[model samples]
Structure formats: C-alpha cells, structure tokens
Target: MDRVWEAELRLPTPLVELRDPLFGTCRVLLKRDDLIHPDVPGNKWRKLKYLVRDARDRGADTLLTFGGARSNHVRAVAALGERLGFRTVGVIRGEERPTNPGLRRAQERGMTLHYLDRATYRRKSDPDVLAALHDRFGGAYVVPEGGTTPLAFPGLAELVNEFDRPYDAVVCAVGTGGTLAGIAAALPAGRRAIGISVLRGAWSLDAEVAALHRSVLGHPLDNWTIDHRFHCGGFARRDARLDTFLARFGDRHGWAPDPVYVGKALLGLSVLTGAGEFDGETVVAIVSGPGAG
Candidate 1:
C-alpha cells in the first residue's frame, strides 16, 4: 500500500477519426480507451476500478480472479494489483504454459497463478470452488472473469460521460457483457450502443448483460443491441478474412489490432457504417485494447 495512485490518473481519452470514403458525411470515430494507461488500459481497467476500491475498503489483502489463458481481464487485474499495491491470485482456465503472454505478465506483476482444467474453470464461481480458494488464499476479494461485478458499472459508466458531443451510436466488442451494459446504461437519450460479440456458443451474453444492467441501474435498457456476425470462429479464434482485415487496417492506420477483440469490432463497424445503418450520423467505435502483437 505504499505506492500512490493519483485520483486524477483516470484521464479522459480522445476520440479519433477512422476514414472510409463510402461513408461520405457519416463519421466513424474511435474512442481511444486502449490508451487510458500504459499498464492498465481500456475496458479492462475501467471495469476494475470500483472493484479494487471495494476490495481495499473491505480490508482485502489479495484479489483472486478467474480468466482464460489470454484474458485481458486477468492481465489488467494483475497489473493493477502491482501498480496500485495489492496481492493477486489468477485462477487461469487451463493449465497454461509459462510462455503464455497473459500468464507470464501476471506472474511478473506478483500475481500467484493457479491452474484448473477447463471443466473446473467453468465452475469458477461455484461456492465450493470459491470456498476452497478462500481457504487457501485467506479472505481475498474475488473479481469474476472480465470484472463483471455490479460495482464495476460505475467506473465504466464514467466512460460514457466523456463525450462532449452526442454520437448516434457507440460500439464495442463484448466478452462478458459488462462493458456493453455499462455503456448502454450511461448513454443519454437518443444515442444507442452496439456490441460485436467475440465469443460464440457460450452462455447467452445478452441475458447476462440484461441482468447486470438491471442489477446496476434498476431497469431494463432498450438502447443497445448485440451483433454476433464478428465472432470469427470464437474467442481468441481467428480466420483469414479477419487476419487480412487486420493487416490492411494496420497498414492504413498504423495501428495493429488484436484479432480477438478490436479487429472484429472495427470490421463490424466498417460493415455496418458502409451498409448505411449509421449513415449521416456520428458513430463511435471503441478501441478496447492495445493489440498484443
């Protein structure tokens, strides 16, 4: 608890223009959440802010969290723990190898890595599993995968308030549904939100978002929709089309996006805008992470 994290470190990021000729008067802007902070950036950090504060308020010494091998959420938690002064334990989805980038970075950040098979990982929030972890790691705070807890909604809602002007729509890639819900909940009247799902055949993300939105904001939200056409196979799965788009986008903009999330999202945004779904209206797409490679 010796390190000082300035309250003002939660800097507001700028929005960038993503040019495409066909859109004509319609503008495509990118909210640069990926640049929020070097170590704890994007929705990953936005989603963790309140959770970390709550954990410290409850006198938690360690934050135990769950995620897949390449989860940005796990990386954010570990990095936050180190930078903000807290112990961390990462319950990884598989028996991840030491070379995995996310796992390696988490370990470097002083987060203890715990492995469980796929089946066990699915039951991560199970009372028995949580109890076992508590028994082993003491009274640590637990952050669900993707930091989807109710407390996180407030931090994410802050992102929506960043716009000085109204946008017709805001878009982001959805993993655990928390980010989408937060954006939708905080949007002013007349604006909308969209989520390009990066996962397929898992639990219903829409249901999860709906439930979380209701839990946090006390009502159902009707201002957003989910587009699943960009999964590109599944979470962390890629295809040639997505790869080609990523390469071309990077070449054009000098920004390489991770295939898992940001790439698909930009592609979806391009498609939707080009198709006139958002023509003549100001649109904003979220760049949620710095591409890993």
Candidate 2:
C-alpha cells in the first residue's frame, strides 16, 4: 500500500495560548489538532492512523466501519480510504439521508454507505449482525464505532508525546473515551488528563475508558478523570446557556467551538476552573475539531 498520505498530515499540531476569563486564574493553551488535515482532523485522524495500517497489513482492500449519519469517524474513514486507494464502506445508524452533508462528502470520496435501522444498529457488534455485514461487504476490515479499539490507542498516545511545553493537565471532550484513555495511559506521574463527557447520563464512561486502558496497556491508569456534568443535555443537543457561551467565545476568540464536543469541554473547564479545581495550574485543552455534520 502507498504511504503517501502520511506525509500530508500535520503531526505535532501547534499549541497556542488561550486567554479568557472563563478559565479563571489558570493559564490555558489550545492544542490545535483540528489543523492536522482538512478532511481527517484531530482525534479522528489519531484514531484512524493504526487502523488503516492494520487493514493494509492484512491485505484488505476494503475498510468498513460503523457510525451515525454525521459521525466524524465515518467521514474520516471515507477520506482516508480515498487518499489511500482503498474501498470504504460506512455502516450508518438510522435512516439514510442522501442530502446529509457529511454523508454526501463521504460518498464523494468514494465510500459506499449502508444504513441500518436503530434496533439493528444497536446489535452492530453481535456475531450474527457482523457476519451478515461481512457477507455483504465481502471481507472488509472492520473498525468499530468511533474507532475506539486498542489499535487506536498508540496514535492517541503520540498526541501527548508531542506536547512541547509543561502543563499541569490536559483536557478534551469525550465521545467514545478513546482519546482520554490514550492520553491517560501516556501521561507521566503528576500530570493528569480530564475528559468532559458529551453524552448526558453517560455515567459509565469512566469504566469504559478504564477498560480501554486495560485493553491497550493491561492495566487502568489513575491519572485521569471524566466530568459528566457539562454535556449540555446530551450528545448533539445544546441549550441556550451553551449557545450564549459559544457566542461570547466566538466574539472574544474569533472562533466558536462546535456544540457537540469541544464547546462542552470548554464549558466544563470554565465551571471546573471557577470552582477552584485548577486554580493556579496551567492547562492544555485539545481542540479536537468542529463537529462532523
């Protein structure tokens, strides 16, 4: 397989200072992973790096992954497949909408999109469902939803290794918990990583992240934590308070984070900082990317 696509990615993405009253007394820096690639950005790129290599090593010409209609993971997979000369299949949850921008972009990148009803999507990992998909797609390499498998950890770990300055903590929004798991696994003693969950009522995210840690390193590390209070209703749902914050953020910073992930993360950081959690510490916030759709 050609390795040309690797050269196009911006590794060790720039870290820039973020000044705002929301962060209270803490000095914050933004890790601009969003600039890594136009199509495959941030943790999406990180998660896919090794999975693509694994697919190639197995002599697979097709990569099939699961996600919702607007998933960044699906879009990234499609873009990666186009760049690397592999066939891509996106097994999407819910009804198909041909007009959806993300899915349309994926299709333009030569991905075959297949939709599964919500109930069937819930069983996406079941043996029977997977077997049927394999039969339909003809031996494609499978990547799970959000690309959270063990193969993804190494790539995410590299993100932490690329930090150029000292920091007391690193923070990011959690969708699948893979990014948190990877960062937590790589952090040296004393420093910590915090995740702001984007899914409401996702109380089990901590366990899920720990399980991911165990999958990658044989044990769960303790230098990380997740804050579930800042999801702003739930995944893909935002209320007036969040909207107002984002508007103010945009006016001050010249860019507004997407409501689904990064915005929620910054909000959590704001609340946490105000509550004296990071009173005098320097923090780095991972700017993952704008939402997929």
Candidate 3:
C-alpha cells in the first residue's frame, strides 16, 4: 500500500500564484492539492491515507463510511478501496439515487451502497445504529462523515510540511473542520490558518476544530479561526453571488472550482481581502478540489 501510494499519488502538490483583482493587496498563492490525484484529490487523500492503513493494521478487510449522495469523501473512499483492494461500503444519507454520478462511481468501484433516512443518518454515531451496521457488514472498520478522525491528522500535517514558501496564513474551505484542524495543528510558530465554512449557521465549527486538536495533539492551539459568514446558503447550496464569482474566477483562472467548497473559500477570501483583512499578507488558499461529480 505504501508503495502504491508513493508511486501513484502526486506529492508536494504545486503551489502557484493566483493573480486576482479581488485580492487587492494580498499576495495570494494557490496550494493545488486538488491535483493530487484524479480520484481521492486534495484533503480527501490526506485524511484517508492513514485511516486505510489503520484499518489494515487492525485486520479489517472492509472500509465503511458515511456520506451524502454527492459526497467527495464517499467517492474517495471507494477509489482508495479500488486501489488498495479493500471492500468498501458507503452509508449514504437520504434516499438512494441510482443516477447520481458520485454514487454511481462508487458503485462502479466496487463499493456497496447503503441508504439511510436523514434522521437515522443524524444518529449514525449512536451505538445502536453502529451495531446494526456492524451486524450487517461483519466488523467493518468505520470512518466518520467527512473522514475526520485523529488518525487523519498525521496525513493532513504533511500537507503543511509540503509548503515550499513562506506565508502569513493558510486557508481552506471547512466542511467537517478536519482539514483546518489538522493544518492549524501543524503550522509553524508564527503562521495561522483560516477556515471558510461551507455550512450555513455552522457556529459550532470552531469548537469542533478545537476538540479535534485536543483529541490528536493533546491540546487545542490558538493559531486557527473559522469564518461562517460565506456559506452562500448551505452545504451544496449556491446563490447568485457565488455563481457570479465562480464564473469570473473560471474565466480568469481557466479552471472551474466546485461551488460546494473551493469556490466558497476563494469567495470568502476575496471578501476578506476587499475588507482589508488580508492586506499586505501572503495567503495560501487550498484548492481542495470539487467533490464527487
């Protein structure tokens, strides 16, 4: 598996300058983690690398995880399973959609799809719900929604270490808060990380990132903060402002970022820059890639 990872995955993903008028005085660079792989791109690769290893170490032959129908995490897990020869099961939230591209890709990659109602999915962490899954799957190793776990931090830390230049701050779109927590935990002494939340009204994201830090690093660090004002609407929801920004961004940059995560983060950064928040600072925005489909 290690050999496969080393041979197949792109390490030290390219860092390139992002010249945008919206950034004003900020020197913005894009950490192109999105280019890490055709499948399992960006933070998905970072978060899952170790969890899969841990599953193997624990003698588990199957990987079980939770995600929405269009979840990038689900597609990444299925891709990893295909690459590494592990049985994969994706417990999807809401009704199954046979035509959903992401779910269909996972199915093609040999992932068993299981659908759960929204209410039951909310209780996925409950022991009873987990036990029921275990009974059906027979002792599969379970990865949480968005693949955020203590085991995931180590791989995420490597992302920070791969930076080839100095910067005042690093930024990424916050979904489960794992990517931000992991990056912030590994940042150098003076640098900081800012997370742009993609979930509307996600006031608890700061607390969640802090708890993740405490879980893995033994204490929470103060080098990180989250911005909840730019969700556009909610997860997978996009409004006219975001759509306009994405269109302009794609026209200028020659790449179209998915509205769900990367687009939202860049839009937030642009707003922050316009407000003089990142004036005269160097910011590296992580292009975590478009989620499945």
Backbone clash pairs in model 1 (N, Cα, C under 3 Å; residues 3+ apart or in different chains), count:
0
Runs of candidate 2 with Cα error greater than 4 angstroms are 1-3, 96-98
Q: Which candidate number maximizes lDDT?
A: 3
lDDT (Cα, 0-100) at 238 in candidate 1: 91
Q: What residue runs in model 3 are displaced by over 4 Å at the alpha carbon?
A: 96-99
lDDT by residue (1-293, candidate 1, tens digit) is 22366453546888877786645567888888888877778887788888898998888879999877767778889988988789999988776543476678889999999988888888888899889999999988988888888877788788888876668899898888888898888888989999999888645888888998778778899999999888889878898878888888778778777788888888787778778788689988888876532
All candidates: TM-score: 0.93, 0.97, 0.97
Pairs in steric clash, model 2: none
Q: Give the whole-model CA lDDT for all candidates, comma-separated.
A: 0.82, 0.90, 0.91
Per-residue CA lDDT of model 2 for 1-293, tens digit only, reads 35587788888899999989888899999999999998999998888888899999999999999998889999999999999989999998986544588889999999999999899999999999999999999999999999988988888889988888989999999998988888888887899999999999898889999888877788888899999899889899998889988999999999998889999999889889989999989899999987857
How well is each residue in 1-293 modelled by candidate 3, as lDDT tens digits?
66866688888899999998889999999999999998889999999989998999998999999988878999999999988889999999986444587788899999999998899999999999999999999999999999999988899889999898889999899998999999998899999999999999998888999898888889989999999989999988999999999999989989878889999999999999999999999999999977556
TM-score of 3: 0.97
Count residue pairs with overlapping backbones in model 3. 0
